[model samples]
Target: MSDPNTADCDSNLHASYYADGMQQVETELVENEQIAQSTYRLRVAAPTIAARAVPGQFVMIRLAGVNAPLIGRALAIYDIVNNDQGDPTWVDLVYLQKGAFTTPCSQSPVGTPVSLWGPLGNGFDPRPCDRLIMAVGGIGQTPMLLLGREANGAQAFGRPNGWAKDVELIYGARNEGLLAGVDDFRQAGFDVQLCTDDGSAGQQALVPAILEQRLQEIGDTASVRVVTCGPEIMMEKVAECCQKHHVDCQVSMETPMACGIGICFSCVAKVKQADGNWDYKRTCVEGPIFDAGKIDWS
Candidate 1:
């Protein structure tokens, strides 16, 4: 198999290379519907951004012609669809209304104009694996939906065989009300295992516990690759579990950013090196996706 880091580095270069050449565009909002408690699915007709988007990549968006929010919000590209001519027609984003920007952004009516830029950051690359396991918690489930869709579609095209034929998603939330898109994932042919802390959903356990148990069940850890995104603590546990099982893992880190193009240096993460060295990498450009083992959990 090729070096995962090399692939990711190449991806980073590509994002930066393209981003430097593309201009931000004003797009029209098509939908802004609440899917779960305080969470919404925002769809926009952004042909340029949509055309360049890759699953796990994101866009920086703000209401067009408005300066009240002051800065754009970095949102994961939840989904992308193409028109008959093979041109991208729409882009989707899933966000939680938790702050000054997201609150009003979520409340914006359909047909409102917004500015968008990207297809930014390195995305997940699930190569050379016999099974792909996705552990998603809270809003971190956003990127996994697209990844699962891609993996499922690839399997149908005879790209991966055996257990890899179906992507397994271990989704967890605080309660049943916070769980979103259970049916959508199932409909997409992913094997979904829903977990909720309050026992109000499919299983009563934290996501990491379920993942640990599942890893033990599989036993052959060498063939499995784990991908996780959520709160830092939860991802730390997932990383530890994958390390213990000798399985490779990747994690998507979430951080506050004023600029999605890596200029502000506000979204930096400490990365651990092979020889016990550490360095900071910008999440907006170098990642949002990174090797779980290389992350400095401390």
Candidate 2:
């Protein structure tokens, strides 16, 4: 497969890839509403960034002039909202307010000046498949919505048409209050399946077990593909289940990042080479999205 990070991060809104020349803009926060328990959906006016963003991509954001936390926080590009003229105007990000950056960010009033950069990292591959299963846990569902929209023909990103015959989301959270955007996924035509650890949502089972059951029901492994994000342990289990069923799987790594660009090695992930040796690859540039089989999950 070709390197997904080589695409131009310019004004080519419909391009299949984006990279290197990502824009850093001084934009103002439009809205920051709490969508779920401790989860806030932040909207920022970043036309240039939003115009080039694809599903599974992320942005580094910080409150302009805030020095207590000097480094920007990496947040997934959840969705893009267009204006009446059909021009991409703002980008939305959903985040759990648990950390230093996020807690303060959530408290910032609307219209606060925000500085953000991106359309960074390699996004999920929009290739066609018979069935696309999104295995998610915690706040991992943030990036899956746009992917689902593209896959179900409701929106277009890199490709012009919907690529999957069907899309199902197996989302798991601690409880019902943490299950953000379930209705949004359903609205986008995904077969929504829910699971929670505390039995406060759809099923009491884990996400990987639910994924395994779905894989078994599908039977035809070649036609199925799985993409997972969330806790590493959960993703590891999802990857294992996909491998056991001979199904192709992709993972969106949530490695801690300092810079959205590849200059900092802070977001490196272990990737397996063809020669059987594993090397560190920068998640910011090489991927946030990687083939599950190529990852050295150890």
Candidate 3:
């Protein structure tokens, strides 16, 4: 078993790295458009953040000088937009418009002053793999687009790009209208397979079932990596699927956070240690992304 003290030290070091790499910025919205049912894509002109951000990282956002919603909301970096010269200029965030913060954010017009900070948390490993399977549910598909583009050689993120020969996305939502950004994934060269609970779109099935079928089709699990986000239960099932297949899996936890930074312990998740014991790890710092096997789904 791993030493719990050693793990704490590592987590502290990781938190320091996050602190050093992040900066707060007061920017303005470039675009905020409704993409799907109750889903909206907000684009912000955060050049510094956009240039530094990689796939799977997220930002904390709030209306500038807003006192009503005291804390910022954490949103994943959906996709980074660039200028004609290929210079990163803005970042896009996709959000479900049900929450208190989101409801207001959706109504905010373009050019609204926004405050945010990030490029925070460890992102998915950009290492090349033979096949990459993205298992996502609900709005979890937000972070997969950029990763897919990087994996397919269409875009480069933090490191050198294009290692996977095949990239597929198995995404599930409550219904067809809620499957946001379907075309975006398709355009990024991902073989997109979609499912819905209500049978409103694609197959009337769950994401994990489709993932299992795809894993069976792939045969060899060695060079495969599965990354998942969205509802915790869904992620747990996806992790279970990966474990059963003996394939590597990474999970983006959706723990609630009062502070997007590591200060608050509100977003801590129980994580297994090398020693076989479990300890709390801050989702905003140590994760938001972690090994599937290490997470204590119980």
The models' CA-based lDDT, in order, is 0.79, 0.86, 0.86
Candidate 2 lDDT by residue in tens digits, 1-298: 2233443222122224335548999988889999999999999888898888888899999989879789988899999999899998889999999988899888989989989999898889887898889999999999999998888788876455588889999999999999998888998889999999999889999999999898888877798889999999999999999999998899999888999787767987888776777777777877889889888899
Q: Report the C-alpha displacement of residue 186, candidate 2, in angstroms.
A: 1.1
> Per-residue alpha-carbon lDDT of model 1 for 188-263, expressed as tens digits?
7878999999999989999999999999999877888889999899999999999999988999988887888877
Q: Candidate 1: lDDT over CA atoms? A: 0.79
Residue-wise C-alpha lDDT for candidate 3, range 7-98, written one tens digit per residue = 34234332443434687999888899999999999999888888887788899999888797888999999999898998998899999999
**Candidate 2 backbone collisions, by pair:** none
Clashing pairs in 3: 1-274, 1-275, 2-274, 2-275
Model 2 worst lDDT run, 10 consecutive residues: 8-17
Each candidate's clash count? 0, 0, 4
Per-model RMSD to reference: 3.8, 4.6, 3.0
